[model samples]
Target chain A: MVLGGLIGLAGCALFPLLWMLSVSLMPPGAADTLPPPLLPQHPTLANYRVLFAQDGMGRYVFNSLLVASVTTLVSLGLNLGAGYAFAKLHFVGRERLFQLLVGALVLPAQVTMMPLFLLLKWMGLVNTYVGVMAPMLVTVFGIFIVRQYARSLPDELLEAARIDGAGEGWIFLRVVVPLIKPIMVTLAVFTFLASWNDFMWPLIILTGQEHYTLPVALAALSREHAQDTGTMMAGALVTTLPVLVLFLVLQRHYIQGLLLGSVKG
Target chain B: MRPQRLTGWLFAGPALAVMTVFFFIPVLGGLALSLTDFDPYALADWHNLRFVGLGNYLVLLERPAFWSALGNTLYFVVAGVPLTMGLALAAALLLNHRLARWQGAFRTALFAPVVTTVVAAAVVWRYLFNTRAGMINVALQAVGLQPVDWLGNPRWAMPTLILFAAWKNFGYDMVLFLAGLQAIDPFLYEAARLDGASAPRRFWHITLPMLAPTTLIVGLLTVAGYFQLFAEPYVITEGGPLQSTVSVLYLMYDDGFKWWHLGMASAIAFLLFALIYAVSFMLLRLARKRGAA
Candidate 1:
């Protein structure tokens, strides 16, 4: 029964993806015909070629990569620093401050989006990548994950470094970072995937076609070319394939990072 | 002061500064903006801004679109959350069964939708759900079932969105529940079996109790997350078929960006915040009534 249910349910979950693959390969106007083709009669690379060369998908891809990577690098540093401090450092109002920060999680991101946009406009960052990336550079959830994982790091390691005449900066760079590298990787994957897939921020902030990330670009394209199924499907495949491949390859870390911050954390 | 005591600030200062400037400030600023009569004109000229305390909220309450958005969001939450949870629980149980094979493959397939780009997925589904030439309609015709216009008809639009949401989300919850299920003591099940209890009874008394906390967390998260529905409809239907799919967040997005009514949009945002906050607390209260998480 589990096997039966498994195939049936998983089939339902994956059917659209398969359909997308099939239709994307179909000849132009094929999917629009009666009893739309289940499989492409003659598969071709024409749509993908058109997307990359003519439609300027290469630019969107580059923009997504640049934004996601930069966000990941910056967030990894900031979140790790703050999380390590909360976990291992002794400070006045430490617990209270951590609690205050954690409490901010309940306020959804949408609540601040409008004002954030206005703020960006004032700062002359509007329509720039910086504007799109600023709001998500560090998340409360990201900090929580680092803090939770870092709490388990043995105190003796930090204390030993301190006893050896190492300063706080040296201790963090030499000891804390290496010890918590796994969590850093998890956070990196999480941030990178999120930044890559994020639509609304880029859609709102990226005013010009030249600046649009893949997801935002695809959304705009879909609206304009709703009649062109093959072209849109090709666009969808390009938008989805990177993250899908990343998840497939590093699914262990991706799923682990998610579960660490969420279910048990 | 001890060096460690001061280093906390040194380490935490950057993150604190970023969050304060980007997140905390905007939250407070959104509240202030909600109290005013700011719009595109105000964006262009600061002098046009007027302090109209509660006026935006009042306007929102009077707007037919706002009520429709709230109703649509409520329908989604009431319908989508339960269906997603139900499917997740069922799938988790099936995968958790000792008799199940190739569980990992099944798990990955089910969870694939969660990571896929929403816009991309919506593109795929929009085609599959096309009014006349959709593959879904073709399949229905093959099966001798009537083909309904999934996204073009107001009655079916929201439901189709709900279905897409559940399909996309249930796997993440299923993974959570599977984790919860694994943590349950097998000895309890053994004891129940020895006592001649049926599988249904074991599930009712043991499985349900063991999963209460997981269920609570998942429920609260799902409810809160579902309230912010924007991407799917924005991508697939564009809140069309006469606006049946316009969620609260979608409405906020339209008002805020499309019309540049930051004041009204901020009010809608706060109202959404209040709603999700209340719903979260209520879910927690409901969970605690049966048992603690």
Candidate 2:
């Protein structure tokens, strides 16, 4: 009975993904036919070819990669510095300021969309890649994660560096950063996947088709090509493949970060 | 001391500045915007903006569409949370069993959906539920059951979104529950068994009580997370077949971005934030009381 239940659970979990792969390779219109074939009798790459060759999917892929990477790099730098400071610094009102930031986490990001659009518009950044990447540049969760990790660092290490005449900037860059490398990687993965999978902000800010990220592009494609099941599935595959691979490779850290973010909250 | 204080500010300066300009300012500005009559007219001309205090909220309260969106959102949270949590608990229990085999593979497969992009999965699911030439209908036909228009029909549209929400989110809760289950001491179950408790009684008496904290946390997190339902409906139904699946966030998006009703959109966003805060606060209070009891 236990074995049977496990098999059933696994099958239910895997069916959608396997079906996604199967349909992506099937001959155009094959999976949509009567008694949907478990295995495509005539497998082909026509759908994928159409997506990358003519549909500007390559450009969208590049845009997703570029945006996610830049956001990850920039946010990591900002979060690590701020987190370490909040953790170890003896500045005035430091505790109050940190509390303010933490308290702001409960305010949903959606609440700021309207005015943020206007703000970006005024800055002449709307419809640009920077606009698409701006709101995500410094996440509260990122700062929190880094701060939590940084708080556990030994105070004597910092004092030793200070007594050795290491400047504050030098301590941050040379001492703090190297010690926090693992959390930085975890933060990078988290930020990258989030920025890549982000739909609403990019969908709102990046107006031009040329600047459309994968999620926004796929959403548009789905709307325009609702009847084209094969092509849509291929688009879905392209949009989801990278992050899915990233999650599978670094799933331990990703899941760890998820629980950390939730439980800490 | 002076240099250390300055250095701390220097380290935190960039992040604080970014959050202030991008996050905090916009949120406060949104609140102010909601009080004014801001729209496309105001976008084109400053003179068109008028200070209309509480006007947008009042207008939204009266509007049928707003109420429908609120109702739809409530329906989603009410239905989706339990379904997802139940499925997650069941999965966790099955995985926790000593008799279960190949637990690693089952765990990974179950979690596969959580990692996939929401827009992409919604797109695939859209096709899966298509009325004609869709697998769901084809299966129904084979089984001598009638095919339901999953996304097209008003009655089934919201339910379809709820089902998709469950499929996408149960994995997250499953992982949390698994962690919680592992934290449970094996001796508790042994004690219950030695006391002549049946399997069901053991689960109810020992397991449930021990898992309360986990359940509360999971419930609060799920409620807050699910309350912000936007991407699924955006990609799946586009708030439609008659706006049956329009969520609060979706309403804000349409008003703010689509129709350029900035003021009204800001009101919707704040209302959503308020609702989530209230709901989560009450749940946590209830959890605390239950814990004390």
Candidate 3:
């Protein structure tokens, strides 16, 4: 009985998302009825048609994909280097600098939005993809996660590589990179998911509708088409499905990253 | 070993530069901006700016909008955090059960929401709670209850958003609690069972105390997260049904981005930062004291 109840609760957890998919396939206005339809009686893709062909959701999808990909790739490289450095390399004030970065984590990102916007505006980056992707290019958490994982690298192995006459850059590229592959995958998945789902910063920085990412564009669409439930669900599905699938595919690494960053850190 | 100082700097410099220029500098600038009347006119011409020296903050203290937003945010954090944590704990406990079937699938199902875009999830939830046509109301009426104006009613709007937030967010803490649960030694529970302790007794004495550290971490994370309630109200109710759902971040967005009141918005941001920092600091202190005791 207990197990059955728990299973039902898990079903409840997935119900809204499943319902969203169901409603998105419904013909417009079919969902707005008493004793509301559980599944579309006549499933159609007209709402999606409207979204892509007319509402220009395709552009937003492209924008989201472009921004998230850039963020993941660039951030992975920068965070990997810095994180590995903090973990193994000897330097003056290395601990102090890492501590400073950790302290900065306590300050909320929202506190910087006003001035950051102004600064971006000064540099003519506001409403551009670069503006949308700038602040996230190197996150403190990313660095922290990478540092935590990189610390587990065997010091003897690094010393062996160094004694064999491998230069620091070559050692990082050939040795450390290969060793930290698991954390790298974890960080990539984490970064991509976060960058894809990020709304507030993109919403703030990208003012032009043409420049808008999926979430921002979806928000704008919802405000304009509050009554158009089918189209709205279609938008939601498009915005969420990629990350959902990505999470499902990379579940282990994603969960590992979560526990590593929170519990152990 | 040689001090690879230059190599280390070379590796770290780019990231440090990004953080310093983008994050740190802007934070310092935000403080300076908060002290001055930085508005649209100031944006247009530098000479239009005037040093206000706490004038914006003084005005915010008297503004009804600021107070209402603060109250709404506090309400969200207080109610939403407990609901999210309770549901998370319950789900984690259930998933942690020895008899639980397909634990991986169930865990993934429970955690799916954490990955979805908040604006998208909020949009989906807004439709689900529609008064006349929504599944929730349909189920309510099926159960012989009156349909609620979930978004349209002033009193109901916040509660609806709370429910939406808990559903969307509980998975995150569930994962945390699961980790916490697994970390506990099973021998304690075995001993409790051997000693004639009932399930409830075991839970109260063994489980709750053992989960205290995890509870503190989860509590701090949830509180800090819930305090920044914006996207749900922004997408679901537009902070509406008479501004009943206006959050501090929403207010900051309106003041800073919408109305171009950069100074006032910076003050709001700083206030929110200070509030979150204070609360988190307190939680950490409280947790340390408990640990010491």
Candidate 4:
């Protein structure tokens, strides 16, 4: 009975994703046929081919990859430096400053949408990749994560390095950077997936089709082609598959980071 | 700890500066903007901006669209939260069973949706829930049920979004619950079994109490997350079928970005922030009191 229950539970959890895969492979109009077929009678890559060639989805895919990767690299640099400082270095008003940053998290990102849009527009950043990447360039959550992980590093190591007359920059690069590689990788993965999956800000900022991220592109596609189930499924598959793969590979760190953020907050 | 003050400042300076310039400034500006009649005209020329004080808020309170948005948001939270938590708890319990095999694979598969881009997944769900050619209706027909227009009907639209929300989110809570369940002592279950407790009884008495903290956190997170319903409604329903899915954020999006009613949009944003703050505070307090009791 217990085994049967477990099997049923697993089945329930996996059904949608499995169904998505099955339906994506089905020939046009097959999936929505009466008594929806579990397996495609005629599998075809026509949907995917059309998505790539006719729909210009491949461009959007490249845009998503570019935006997500750039955001990750840039933010990682900013967060790592700042996180290390908060954790290891002594600074003026450090506790109070950190508290203020944490407090800002309560102010939902949406609160800033109106003004930030105007701000970006004024800066001529709107509809540019930089515009999509700007607000996400340095996140408080990323700083907090890096700080939390950095705090565990031994003070003696840094102290010893400093004693050897190494400058702050040198210490950061030669000592700190190499030491925190794991957390850095973890933070990089976290930032990349988030930027990749982000829909709202990108949707708002990237008004032009040329700059549209996958989520925004997919959303537009869904709106325009509501009847084209197979094609939309193909779009969804394209948008989702990359991040899904990343999560599957780095789930441990992702879950750990999630819990850290949640519990700490 | 030497030169700690300067070093800390140096470390935190870049992030703090970025956040302050981009995040803090805009939020404060948002509040200030809410007090003004900042419209599309203001977007073009600063002279067109008029200081309206509480006029925007007053107007919003009397607006039918605002009320509808609030009602839709409430419907989403009230209906979506419990359904998500319940499903998550059920999944967690099933995974916690000793007889469960292939647990890792099952967990990953379940969580796959959570990691998927919301807009993308929402797109897929839109197709799946489509009226004529949707696989959902086809399956319903096979099961001897009449096909319901999932997204087109005002009555069924919000519920469909709620169902989608539950499916998309429950896996997250399931993981949290699984962690919480693993932390529970097995000896308590053994004790319950020895005392002639049935599985359900054991679950009710021992499982629930020990899992209280987890449940509280999950509930709080779910409520907060659900309150910010935008992308799902945007992609799946477009807050459509008689505006049944018009969430507060969606309303703000429409007002601020689409219509260029910057001042009114800012007001809606602040109002949402206030509501979320109040609700989460009350929830945390209630949880603490329950724990004390």
Candidate 5:
């Protein structure tokens, strides 16, 4: 009984996605059916082909890939340095500043959106890739995660490095970077997935179709081609397949980071 | 430890600088922006700007759209949070059950939606809930039930969104509940079983209490997350079908970007922040009273 119930819930969770996959592969008019066939009668890649070649979806996919990857790499660098300093380095106003940051987390990111848009406009970045990528290049949560992990690193190693004539930059690159490699990977994945999935800010910023990320493009497609279920599903599939694959491959780091975040900051 | 002020500043400078210039200053600027009549004219040329003080906030209170947006947002929170939490608790309990097999697979399947791109998933959901040729309508016909326009009808729109939001989010909370369930001692259940307590009785008395802290945290997180509903409505309904699914954040996006009403949009943003902050504070206080860590 328990097993049956569990499977039922899991099936419900997965049914929509499975159905989407089935319909995406179906011939053009196949999904408009009586019983809604469980499997495509003749599976074809025509929808995907049309999406990439005709609809210019490949550009959106490339945009999403570029933005997410750049945001992840840059965020990893910024957060690692700041978080390590908060954890291991002693400085004036360290505790106070960290406390201020933790408090600021309560203020929703929306509070900054309107003015940040103006700020980006003044810097002549509005409607550009740089505008969409600017504010997200460093995240408070990323810094917090790195700081939480970095606190566990022993100071003795850093002191010994200093005694060996290693500067702060050299020690960070050689010592700290290797030690916190796991969290760095985790943070990278987190930032990448988030930027890929992000909608609102990108929607607000990217005014032109040429600059639209995959999510923004999919949203536009859904509105314009509301009748084209097959193509919409294909678009959705391409957009989601990458992150889903990454999650499956690095399942441990993702879930570990999730639990660690929930249990701690 | 000796203070390394110079090195610490050097290490933290770039991030702190970015945060200050982009995040902190803009947050303060949003508040300042809210106090002015910074419309599209102001955007075009700086000569149109005017310090309106509380006029924007006052104007929002008078506006019917703002109230409707707030109502829709509250409806989502009041409706969506409990539904999602209930599903999460049930799923967590089922996965934690002693008889459950292939637990990891089940957990992964259930949690997959949380990781998927929202816009992509929302597209799939839009297809499934389509009015005419939708799979849902076909299934309804199979069951001899009438079809309803899930997204096109204003009444059903929010509820359909609530259902989709719950499905997308419950897995995340389920994981949290699973962690809480694991932390509970088996000996407690052993004791209850020995004391002639029925399974339901044990669950009601023991499981619920043991899960209270997790429940509080989950509830807070869910409420906070749900109150900011935008993308689902944007992609699915476009806040359409008579503006039924217009959330506060959605309204802010429309006002700030679509219409270029920066002052009014900033006001809406701060109002939302205040509401979330207040509710979070209350939840934290309640958790403290319950000795929740």
Candidate 6:
């Protein structure tokens, strides 16, 4: 009975994506009819073609890719370094600072948006990719996750590297990096997925249509093409597919990070 | 400073700098801005800004729209939290059961929604819940029932948002609960079974009690997340057929960005922060009380 229930719930969870994929493949006006077609009798990529060809979806895809990739690359380094330091290195007020940051998590990102926008404007980054990327460059949760994982790393190895005359940066590069490779992947997937899926910040910061990431662009497209079900579904598929695939491929690391950051931490 | 301390500072500097400059400072600055009448005029010229000293908060308190937004957000949290947690706990329980199969595939399928872009998912939901062309309506009509206007009706709009929120989020909590369940001693369950306890009794006596901390954490996170309801409403309903779905954050966005009432927007943000903090505090207290009892 429990197994049956699980299967049913799983079906409910998976159906939206299946329905989306099926409808996106439908010919124009095909889904507008009564008793919506479960499968396109003659599935076509026409909606996808329209999205890319006419709607400039390729540019938004590029924007999302560039932002998520760069943000991931940059954040992995920053979060790892800070996390390792918090775990191993001794600093004045380290505990207090970390606590402060963690406590600040309750303050929603929306609170920062208005002033962050002004600050970015002052820095001449308004409507730029940099503005969209700025707030995501370092995240408190990312740092917390890394710190939790990094604390589990043995101190003997780090001391051995130190006694062998390895500098902090060199130790981090040569000794620590290899040891924390699992977390690196986990954090990378976490950061990448987060940056890819982020909406409100990007929507607020990237006012220009050209700079809009996939979510922002998809949202804009949705508002305009609310009536165009097939094309909109195609847009939804395009925005979702990459992150979905990434999460599936890196499922282990992602779930590990989720558990680490929430339950165990 | 000692070399070790200096090294620690160096390692932590970049991330700290980014967090400080981009996030921490803005949060404080937002608070400061809330104290003044910061409007577009102030945006153009800082000279136009004047100290209002809780004036924005007072004004927001007086505004009916703000109250309705708060009501709408509270409605989402009150209704949505239980639904999300209940589904999450149910899924986690089922996944954790001995009879469960294809566990990995099931986990992946369930968690997929959590990873999808909110705007994209909202778009899919918007279409799925569309009045005439939507598959939901089509299915309803096929069943020989009257089709409901899911988004277009004020009464149904918030509930639709709640459903979307639950579907999007429940998996995250489910995963957390799975971890919690695994941590429970198998001996305890074996003992309970030997004591002639039925499955339901074992669950209530063992599982729910054991899972309380996880439940508290999940509950807090879900409530906090649900409070910040923006993207779904913005993407799906645009806050309405009649502004019935406007959340506190939505109001803040409207005030801060759309109207350029930065001061009022900042006030709204702080108010939301306080609300979340209070709710979390009360939840923790309640959990502590339960534990003590």
The most accurate candidate by DockQ is 1
lDDT of each: 0.89, 0.89, 0.91, 0.86, 0.89, 0.90
Task: Please give the ranking of all candidate structures by DockQ, highest first, separated by commas.
Answer: 1, 3, 6, 5, 2, 4
- Candidate 3 regions with alpha-carbon error over 4 angstroms: B1-3
- DockQ of the two-chain complex in candidate 3: 0.80
What fraction of the true interface contacts does model 6 reproduce?
0.85
Per-model TM-score, in order, reads 0.98, 0.97, 0.98, 0.96, 0.97, 0.98
Native-to-model Cα distance after best TM-score fit, residue A199 in candidate 5, in Å? 0.4
Report lDDT (Cα) of residue A167, candidate 2.
Answer: 85
Model 2 error, position A236 (Å) = 0.4
Error of 4 at A4 (Å): 3.3
- Residues forming the 10-long window of minimal summed lDDT in candidate 5 chain B: B1-10
Leading candidate by lDDT = 3
- Tell me the tens digit of each residue's lDDT in model 2 across A55-164: 88999999999999999999998998888888999899999998898899889898888899999999999999999999999988998999999999999999999899
Candidate 5 CAPRI grade: medium
Error of 6 at A194 (Å): 0.8
Give residue A70's error in model 1 in angstroms: 0.6
Q: What is candidate 6's lDDT per residue for B198-229, written digit by digit as tens? A: 99999989988998888888888888888888
Docking class of 3: medium
The C-alpha stretches of model 4 lying farther than 4 A from their native spots are A28-37, B1-4
What lDDT score goes with residue B65 in model 1? Answer: 98
